[model samples]
Target: MSIDLQSKLTPLPRLYKEITLDVGGEAVHLIIRRPPRTVMAMLLSEARKAGELDEQDKPKDGGCAMRLMARMAASVLYAPDGVRPLYDRKNPEVIENLVENAEWLLDIQEDVVGALGANGAVVERIQGNSEATQT
Candidate 1:
């Protein structure tokens, strides 16, 4: 029997959420896109460069973790239409932007992380499973 690799290897669905923030007096709309599986490696590389990770690629500290969350939020940010990426993975400007708006990073981080399986939905589902179901 011949196997079809293309049919077996399906891409992960892109996750995103539409958000609105009050920047100054006006409400600014944006899309928070979850980093696609294809760019996970690049994002990790960026985290390392931003000092969020050590040489071993492990998290350095709490502060670094915060920075990483901010970086993730920043890189995944998109235009309100959700089609245009506001920040490019290859652009160093994202780091500068994150630094300049450090105060908002945590807020953004919560939303970004919350979007992940509704913030631990998968874990909760697995944990709620009964022993009989495990069989």
Candidate 2:
């Protein structure tokens, strides 16, 4: 007897965008995808544990934000040629490579975070659903 292993749910495609960044005088073409919720959750958890905050809200661990930025860059970064992922989120070596290019990585992370947070339409609908549930 064969059981249906396929999911019955419809697939929702993730958002993607392309960009070219100048890294150390080299033109790097990247395809950035909106990070999935799991990656976002991991980012949040990593950020929370990466530093301590006092009343002034100053980060005691200076590398915390940088590490998060590296992770974000790793998560969303993809090669434009075949849409290949340049780095794996689970691999520290690949993440460290991103850290080495901190200057340009910051720019890459900016775009990645923008993609992650750019779901204005979805946010509105989700907020509406929450409001309706509370009513």
TM-score of each: 0.58, 0.61
lDDT for each residue of candidate 2 in 15-67, tens digit (9 for 90 to 100): 46889888789987778877666676675455455443223222334454456
- What pairs collide in candidate 1? none
The CA lDDT of each predicted structure is: 0.56, 0.57
State candidate 1's TM-score: 0.58
Top candidate on lDDT is 2
RMSD of 1: 9.5
User: How far does residue 52 in candidate 2 sit from its true spot (Å)?
Assistant: 8.3
Residue-level lDDT tens digits of model 1 in 1-135: 334654356432354677777776677787876665545456667776766665555556655555555555656777865454576545556655665674666656556655442324322221232221211
Badly placed stretches (over 4 Å) of model 1 are 1-15, 49-51, 61-63, 114-135
Instruction: State candidate 2's TM-score.
Output: 0.61
Candidate 2 local distance difference test against the native:
0.57
What does the lDDT read for residue 29 in candidate 1? 83
